[model samples]
Target: MAKQTAKTTKRSLAVINTIQKLGGATLDELTGELEIARSTIHLHLQTLLEEGYLTKEGAVYHIGLRFLNHGEYARSRKKAYTLAKQTVTELSDRIDEEVEFVVENDNRGILVHESFHPDSHFPSKERHISTAPSSAGIYYYLHSVATGKAILAELPDERVEAVLDDRGLPRQTAHTITDQDDFIRELEQIRDRGVAFADEEYVDGLREVGRRVTGPDGSVLGAIAIIGPKYRFTDERYTTELPEILIEYVDDLETEISDSYLDDYR
Candidate 1:
C-alpha cells in the first residue's frame, strides 16, 4: 500500500479532531471551524461516513462508536494498563480516596487508569492533561503532583531542563515554585526520599502523593498517585504513612511489569 501524503493526513486528522471537539456538528460548523470550503468539508465527511468512522443525524455529524474498538485494542497492548487496574482499585479502597495511574506521553501525563471512592470528588480526573501546568492556570508544578514530581525526579537533568524550557514554570498558586533553582532543589529532595507530594500547590484544597514505576533496567514506566482533600491527607500522613504505602504498591507493580513485560522497554 502507498503511504498517505502529508497534506491529506493533516486535513483528515484535523477534520476528525474538529468533530471530536464539538461533540457533534453540522457541515457548516465543521467548515467554519476548519476554515475549509463547504465542498471540501463535505467531501471528507462523505468519505468518513462511507467508511463508518462517522455517523449523521438531522444534518449533524458525530464520531462513530467504532473508535472504541480501536481504543480498546491500543489499551490492551499496554501491560501497565492491566497491572495498574488492580493496584489502583486496591489503593482507592485502602485509602478511601481517589487514586490514579498516569503515563507520560510526549512530555505530558495521561490519566490511563483511575479508582476513587463513590463519595469522593476529584476535579483533576480529566482523561488527559499536562503533568506540569494544569489547565486551570493551576501549576501542578512538576514538583507539585506526586506523579509529575516523581517522574521528574527520576529523569536526567538535561531532559528535565528541556521540559522546563518548553513549558515554563508558571505559578498556579501561592505555594507553586516559580524559580527553576527552587524546583530543582525540590526534585533533589524527592529523589532522596523516592516519593513526591502535591502539597496544595496544584489545587488549594487538594493533596497527592506519588511514586514512580520503573522497569527492570530502570526505564521509567509511569507514576501512580493517591489523591484527596488536604484536610484528610495531612502533612504528617503525606511525609510518613502515605509514601510507605504508595511505594509498596509501586514496587509490586514495577516487579510484575519488569518480569512480564520487559519488552516494553525495547
Candidate 2:
C-alpha cells in the first residue's frame, strides 16, 4: 500500500506538469519521457479524472473540453470578427483584389475569413492560394506573403523569435526572406508603419499590399489584404492611392464592428 501511494503521487505530479506546460501530452510521449509503468500512470490519471483536472483519450491526455467551451463562447461574443466582414468583402470589390481576414491563433496568424476574385482564386507569390480547405490555412509559410508578414509584424519580438526558431525559414521562392536579420528588420518596419508588403518577394509576378486591422482593445485582430500581379498592382492602385484607400476601409470596418456590438447590447 505504501509503495502504491508513492507511485501514485509521482505519477500525479507528472500528469499535472505535462498538462500545465505542454497543453497536451500523448501517452507514448509521456511514458517514454517519464519512464513510468503504464499501470502506475493509469492509476494516478484515474484520480485526476475524478478530481476534474485532466482528461485522457485513447493514448493522449489534454486539457478538458470544458475550458474550450468557455473559450469558444468568449470568442463568439467578441466584436472583432462580427464587425469586420462587410468591410472586408467591400474592400475586395473596391480594389477587385483578393482579400482575407486573419486572427492570431496558436501564436500564428490563421486566415479565418476571406473574399476573393469571382472564382475565388488568388495568385500568391510563389504558390497559388486555393479556396479549398486543403490549401487555405495549411499552404503558405508565415513568411511567404505580405498578408502573413502584416500579422507577424504585430507580435511581440520574443514570441516571433520563438516561432522562427521553431520553424526556421524554409525557402519557397528566391524572393522569400530567408535571412533572420533581414526578416527582423522588415518586421520592425511593419511595426513602425501600419502595413507590410510583399513585392514579388515570395513569388514571381505577384505583389501584395497588406495592412493591420485592430480591435478596440488594440489587439491585432488580423490583416485585410489586396494581392495581384506586379504589373497591374504596381501601376494602378498599389503604388498610386491604395494605401490610403485600404486604411479608410479599415476605419470603416472598426466603426461598423463597434456598431454591431452596440446593436447587440441594445
Candidate 3:
C-alpha cells in the first residue's frame, strides 16, 4: 500500500511538471514524456481535472487558475507583505522611484511587493516588478543586488559563509565583487553603515540603495530598496544625501513592523 501511494505521488508530480514545462500538453505528449500507459495517464488527468487542479481545452491540458488563488493567499499571509502593503506606496511617492520590498527565501531573494511612483519608468519588460525571478528576468544573488546584500549583512558570519559555500559568488556584471574575502568586507561595511549600495554591480546601467528592516530581536524581516538608472543616481547623492533618508525610511518600517507583528508573538 505504501509503495502504491509513493508511486501515485511521483506520477502526479511528474505529470504536473511536464505540463508546466510544455506550457500545455496533450495526453500523447504526457504519455511520451512519462513513458506511462495511456490509460493510466488519462486516469490521472481525469482526477486532476475533476479536482480543478488542471483544466482541459479540447486536446490539451493546462494548469488551472486555482493555483493563482493559492499563490495570493500565501503571499497575503507573510508578515513582511502585510507590513509593506501599507507603507511601500508612501515610500515610492516620497522617493519618486520604484520601491521594492524583498524577502530572503532560503538562499534566494523573492520580491514580495513593489510600489512605483507616477513618474517611474521601468525601462524593460525584464526590469519590471514581480515576485517570481524567472518571470521578472532578474537574478537572485545575495552578494550582488542591494536588497540581497542588506539581508546578507544581518546574517551571522558563519551563516554567511555557508551561503557563500553553497552558492559561489557568480559575477553578474564587471563591477560585481566575486572574491569571498572582499564580499565579507563589504558586508562588514554595510553592518557599520546600516545600509547597502549596489553600484552597477547587478546591472550595467542601474544602481540601487537598500537597508534591512528587522524585527525587535534583530532578525531580518525584509529589505526595502530604491532603484533607478545609474545616470540619475549620482555618486554625490548616493554617498551623502540618499543614505540618510533611506535609513530613516527603513527605521520607520522596522518600528512599524515590530510593533504590529513581532510584538504580538512576544
Candidate 4:
C-alpha cells in the first residue's frame, strides 16, 4: 500500500510538471507525452483539478495561478531575494544596463529578479529580455550564464562535480565551454578574480559580468550580474569596468544582507 501510494503521488506530480512545461495540455496530449494510460492520466488530471492545482478550458488543462501564491511565498522567505531586487534595480538604473539576481536550486540557477535600465535599448535581434510579465522564475543551466558560473565558483568542488554529473555541460552557444576540464579551469579563474564573465556564451551578442554574494555566515546566497550587448561590453568594460562595479555592488549587498539578518539566521 505504501509503495502504491508513493507511485501514485509521483505520477500526479509528473502530470503537474508536464502541464507546466507544455503551458497547457489536453487529455490526449498528457496521456501520449507521459506514456501512461488515458484512464490513469484522466484520473490524475481530475484529482489535480479538484484540488485547484489545475484549470481547464475546453479540452486543455493548464497549471493554475494558485502556484503564484506558493512561488511568491517561497521567494518572500529568501531575504537575499528581497534585498537583491532593490539592489539590482538601483544598479540597473545607475549603469543604464540590465541587471539580474539568480539563485541556485537543484543545481540549476533560478532567476529571482531582473531589472532593466529606463533608457536601455537593444537591437531587435539582440533583445534578450523575456516578453513575460517578469523574467523571474526562469531557470538556466549553471554552466551557461555569468551569474550561474559565479555561484558555481563559490560551491565546493564535490558539489560542482555533482551538478555537472546531473546536468552535464550542454552547449548553449559557440563560445560555451562544453568540456568539463575547461569549465573547471574557468571556475578557478572566477574564484581568483572574484568575478565571472559570459561573452555570448548563453545568448548571442549578449555579454555579462557577475559576482557571487554570500551571507553573514559565509554561506553562498546567490549572484548578481550586469548585462548588455557585446558592443557596449567592450574588453575594457567587460573585464575591468563592469566587473569592478559588479564587485562593489555585490560587496555592498552582502554587507546589507549580513547586517539585516542575524548571523545564525541564514
Candidate 5:
C-alpha cells in the first residue's frame, strides 16, 4: 500500500504530461503509450477528472483549463516578467520584427512574453514560432537560441556547466554549436560584447540578436531578443545595428525593473 501510494503521484503527473503532449488521449491509448495497466490508468484519469485537472469528452481525455490558472499565477509572481512584457511590445513595434522575452528555468528557456510586428513574416511550418498568446509557454534549448545563450552567458561558469549537463547541446541546425569547448568560447564572446547572436542556429532561415537583462542586485532576470529572416539581418545589421538597438531596449528594461524593485521598499 505504501509503495502504491508513493508511486501514485509520479504516475499521475506522467499521465497528465502524456495527455498534454498527445493533445488528447483515450484510456487505452494512454495505457499503450505509458505501458501502465488499464485499470491503473483509469483510476488516475478519474482522479484527475474529479480534481478538475482533466476533462473527458466521449472516450477522450484532455488537459483541463485549470492549468492556465496555475500558469498565470506562476507568471504573475515574476515582477520582471510584467515589466519585460511592455519592453518586448515596444521593441517589436519599434523594429517591426518579432520580439521575445525569455527566462531560464530548469536549464531551459521559457517564453514569458512575445510580440510580433504587423509586417513580420511567419517562418515555414517546420519552425515552431507561434503568434498566439499561448506561445508564452514555449520552451527552447539554451544553446540553440540567442535569448537562451544570452541568459547562459550571464550565469556563472559552474551554473552554465550544470545547464549543459542537464540539457545536452542538441543540434537544431547545421550552424548550432554542439561542442562544449566551442560553446564555452561563444559564451565568452557574448560576455565581452554584451550581446549574443544566433544565425540560423535554432531555425534554418531565421536569425536573432539578444541581450541579457539584469536586476539592480546584478542577478540575471532574463533575456530579450529580436528575431527576423536572415536576409533582413545582414552582416552590418546582425553584427552591429540590431545588437545596438537590442542592447538599448534591454538597458531600459533593466533600469525599469531596478526602479520598480526600489519603489516596492519605499
Candidate 6:
C-alpha cells in the first residue's frame, strides 16, 4: 500500500511538473514524457484538474483560466494584457513575491491580474499557483488593503470622502489607519510617495505594497502590488523594495497602455 501511494505521488508530481515546465501540454506529450503507466498519468491529470491546478482545453491540458482571470481583467484595461503582463512578469522576477494588477469594481478594489513566484519559492507544497480573485460585489472594504489606498489616491477629495462616509474606517489591525481625517492625510502621503502600504492591514502576517495603476492619460485605473508573508516582507524591506518595483511596473504598464490607445487610433 505504501509503495502504491509512493508511485501515485511520483506520477502525480511528474504530470504536474510537465505542465509547469511547458505552461501547457497535450495528453500525448505528457504520456511520452511521463514514464508512468497511461492509467497513472490519466489519474494524476484528473486530480490536478480537479484540484484547480490544471485545465484542459479540447485536447490541450494547460494551466487553468483561474490564474488568468486577473490577467484577463488587466488586459481588458485601456492598454490590455500584453503590456500589463510585461510589468506583471518583471515584478514577480524582481521581488520573488506574488505580483498583481488590480482594478476598481464599483466601490471595491478588485484583483484583476496576478503573477506567481517561480516554482522555486512557491509557498505551497501543493504544486502550482492557485490564487484566484474573489468576485466583485462581495463587500470587501476599501481600507482592507494597500491596494485600496492606491485606488483611493486617484479620487477627488469629495469622492474619497463619500466612499469613506459610506464605509466607515473599521480597523483591520492596530496598524490600520482608521480615522477618516488621518486616513485622508495618509492617502495624500501615498500620492506624494507614489505607493500604498499595507503593514499587515488586510491579514495579519501578510503584507502588500501597492501603487496606482494608470491609463494613458494618467487617470488611475486601479492598483497593483507585490505581496508576501510578513516574515519575508518586513516594513524596512517593503520600504526599500515596493516603491522601486511598483514604479517600474507602473511605467511598463503605462507604455503598454499608450501603445494600446494608439492601436485604436490607427
Give one digit per residue, the lDDT tens place, for model 3 in 1-266. Answer: 54446888788878987997798999999988997898988999999899888999999999987777876786688666777756667888887987777778768787767776666555642453233443322337778889999999999989898888988899988999999999999999999988899998877777889988888778888788887777778977777677787888778877787777756678
- Order by TM-score, highest first: 5, 4, 1, 3, 2, 6
Which candidate number maximizes lDDT?
A: 5
For model 3, give the 10-residue run with minimal summed lDDT: 129-138
lDDT of 1 by residue, 1-266 (tens): 99867886678778888997787899989888997778978888899889888999999999987776786675457776788778999888987888877766656566667776875565553423333322222123354567888888899999999888977777766887779998999999988989888777776777889988887778787789888887788767877898899989888887787777656446
Candidate 2 regions exceeding 4 Å error are 1-78, 119-127, 131-139, 260-266
C-alpha displacement of 108 in model 2, angstroms? 3.1
Tens digits of per-residue lDDT, candidate 6, 125-227, equal 1122233232222234677687788889888989888888877788766687887888888898998988888877766676778888777777777777787
Order of all candidates by lDDT, from best down to worst? 5, 4, 3, 1, 6, 2
Higher-scoring candidate on TM-score, 4 or 6: 4
Model 1, residue 172: C-alpha shift (Å): 4.3
lDDT of all predictions: 0.77, 0.70, 0.80, 0.88, 0.89, 0.73
Kindly list the per-residue Cα lDDT of model 2 for residues 145-262, writing each as its tens digit: 7767887888788988887887778786678899999999999987876778888775777777778777666777777777777666766577547777878888888777667657
Question: RMSD per prediction, one decimal?
Answer: 5.4, 8.3, 4.6, 3.0, 2.9, 13.6
> How much does candidate 3 score in TM-score?
0.79
* Residue pairs that clash (backbone atoms under 3 angstroms), model 4: none
Per-candidate TM-scores read 0.81, 0.63, 0.79, 0.92, 0.93, 0.63
Total backbone clashes of candidate 1, pairs 3 or more residues apart or in separate chains: 0
lDDT winner between 2 and 4, please give it.
4
- Candidate 4 global CA lDDT score: 0.88
lDDT of 4 at 151: 95
Model 3, C-alpha of 63: deviation from truth (Å): 3.7
For model 3 the local lDDT of residue 238 reads 72
Off by over 4 Å in 5: 1-6, 125-133
lDDT per residue for candidate 5 within 1-266, as digits (tens), equals 44545678889999999998888999988988997888999999999999899999999999998998999888779788898999999999898988988999878999888887877665551247554534788889999999999999999989999999999999988999999999999999999999999989998888989999899999998899999888888889889998999988888888888888889999
